[model samples]
Target: MSIELNEADLVSVSVGGAIAHPGFPGLPAEPYRLAADGTPFLLPTFGGIVYNVSVGDRAFGWAADCIHPGVSIKGADDLKNRGLNVFSCLGNTAVVMTGQAQGAKGVVTGKSGRFSEQVIVHFPVEVRRKMAVGDQIVVRALGTGMEIRGHAAVACKGLSPSLLKALPKKVEDGVLKIGVVATVPAHLVGAGAGLTSEGGSLHIQTTDRAEVEKAGLSSLRLGDVVAIENTDSRYNHGYLRGALGIGIVGQTDGPRAGYGPGLTVIMTAPKGELGSFAAPGTNIATLLALEP
Candidate 1:
């Protein structure tokens, strides 16, 4: 199915500077463990160019709570309230309007709001080098009133028509089955909790080596679509048994005690409202035909 957007759906935002990673505040004598040699360290978070990573890479990084290739609109409250964050769909064009990279173009990879609302974009390493914080970037926000035909219960958020078209879907026994790489339990969810799904993401806890191995969280890669069980992310994230949240793995976190890969919500619904089948190839890279 095809959806159209009008002029009113578009909005623009300024690219803000990278957010420095503040070590766990208030922790006694080094909040967490250091390297094997007892050297102190902290993981990179928001802002700046992430040269070594891209859209389809694994989410595991050496830096804790790291957010790659961060780009945000300063004072995003107005845009967020008006659905800029919600409608700035993935695969949307992001054009650099200032700095050395002026006129450079990139693609919106995902949306996140761990500390504040921001849109994560992917640009070439060389272009990223010339980009600076506070650069002007424009996005054509377009994902509103999106729906899955014959499935009114399923709610679509932060998804672009281009992204939707790339996804593979089918009807199975009267249930709309979307392809996903894995299904994660709600109990394993961390960070970005108590946050509205408007423009945010939740972390998949991977601190415990045993739990990480058991849940297969370690194998998760960026862009993979995973089913989150027993959670409602329509408006706000909450415990709702039987609810399911289908999201894309957006960002990788360092081996923080409680943080791991981040899940950016794409579609969500109440219990028994939607179903999914394990399909490993159902990822942003595969759907959009981007280099893996």
Candidate 2:
């Protein structure tokens, strides 16, 4: 047996939803949800901006000595395990303290956490730098991973335009089930899922009929973990497909053709696997010959 990596960094970036501050203008809705109340938030998106890094960049995703090596923190190694990072706050109503506009607080939007010494808050750049590094950030984590129960990442190997084309056209609708949780938009599938050898599952696809036809899986990258399962599984049930044996997620040219906004399970599963995390009908507990 091998030893599991148990190194939970001393400090993890806190994340939360944004809540509209009192008397805040614009869309009069609660942007800062309970996550602003100081709860645990998980899953940071790739190439997303936190304190300094811009959206769609991986400058600060790793648990390294220097977290956000650009804007927030000057030196990455210096801020390895410090007191705290302001970006830790995920979603909450926040007041801009420093920079050009001071005291002008806005609802703390989504937080970019996970090993970032410099936290990422989703606020207008003009007013994001309320607190500097080591400042207090708030967040409220709700529910649990169970919220996405009975789901799995679609795994693949040696991803390429050709590999994606090889996927089953339709396995007879009732044969397979797919689970799509926290799905990202299919139209925006370019590079959203990296082509790493991890788990190799692609668990999501485009519901936009037109996009699926022209784009197909060609837009998807290798090692992309797409979610798939059966219908009637839950909120993400219809997302799970039983048609093509395991459902359709990536580039395909077959009978199944309805793609929708879905989650990118690429990170959850291991490298070079076919499918990770079984869907609703999948014998979750039952051992399978294909499991890694």
Among all candidates shown, the one with the greatest lDDT: 1
Candidate 2 TM-score, C-alpha based: 0.26
RMSD of each: 4.4, 18.3
What would the TM-scores of all predictions be?
0.81, 0.26
Query: lDDT score, residue 19, model 1?
Result: 19
Predicted structure with the largest TM-score when compared to the true one? 1
What lDDT does candidate 2 reach at residue 262?
23
lDDT of 2 by residue, 95-197 (tens): 4444444555333211111222222233445444443433333433211121111223332221222212222222222222233212233333322233322
State the lDDT of candidate 1 residue by residue for 242-270, as single tens digits: 88988888888655544667788888889
Model 1 quality (TM-score) = 0.81
What local lDDT does model 2 show for residue 234?
A: 19
State model 1's lDDT.
0.69
Which ranges of candidate 1 are over 4 A from the true structure?
1-41, 69-83
Provide the lDDT at 51 for model 1. 66
Give candidate 2's error at residue 59 in angstroms.
Answer: 7.9
